[model samples]
Target: MRNLEQVLAHAENHCENNGSRLTIKRKQVLTGLLISDKALSAYELIDFCKGEFGETLQPMSMYRILDFLNNQDLVHKLNLANKYVACEYINCNHEHLVSQFLICVECQSVKEINISKTVMTELQRNVLQVGFHLVRPQLEMNCICDACITSQA
Candidate 1:
């Protein structure tokens, strides 16, 4: 609960600074994401809102909210799994160097990682060599988690 409050507070401050309004509905969506252990799709978020808050959020509305959250740097969209996760480093805006997502192919679990600056520079340089610019340097890697691999074995 305390953690949620802190996240909420940070979000509020961020919204204020960025000239954006974090409405109650947006907060509700963010709360759902924060409480979930795994990345959640928009439909999953809608179900969660209905189940937990007794409110129904339409898919279109959810998409708008997700877009706002992503713009605010409060959420990340995992392309591999087509799900959203609240940014783990919510309080530190400066710490966002390059976010790497390690996704478990079997269970859709995601782990956020930061590679060293040297590595990030190298990656950017390589992309430039190929005539591509990285708007945001994020790498999504697909792998089976240890638990999944062990279970399979």
Candidate 2:
């Protein structure tokens, strides 16, 4: 994983290249996600901003920021947990592959993994065979994280 400064710089460059601006609040929100060890909901982000950056963010505003970040692919929304995490590939210059999330059901920790093109092709084929078009190729799988499992044991 890239350092926070490098990731943020990469995100800034990426946004500028896309003809969009990464505003201060957006940076703050992205920073919160990058620093967090787990995915965070908008409310948690609001709290993070208030506590960490001494900034007060309204829920609607926070959602908009999250939406912008998601659109930029600088962050990803984990639908299974209804939370968001910073994109792990922010510092990478290559195009992204199909991404899957391993979400810890017990602790809500998330890990992003890339699926091989061959596997993604097979999955898409299966989807098409069922007469359903695969819209978002991202997958979110629920599981227990190592820490959670060890605690249970």
User: Of the candidates shown, which would achieve the greatest lDDT relative to the real structure?
Assistant: 2
Q: Candidate 2: misplaced stretches above 4 Å?
A: none
Full-model lDDT for every candidate: 0.89, 0.94
Per-residue lDDT of candidate 1, residues 1-153 (tens digit) = 238998898998999999999998899999999988778999999998899889888999999999999999899999878899988788776857678988888988777888889999998899999999988777889988898999999
TM-score result, candidate 1: 0.92
Alpha-carbon lDDT of model 1:
0.89
TM-score to true structure, per model: 0.92, 0.96
What is the alpha-carbon lDDT of model 2 when measured against the actual structure? 0.94
Minimal lDDT window, size 10, model 1: 88-97
The Cα error of candidate 2 at residue 91, in Å, is 0.7
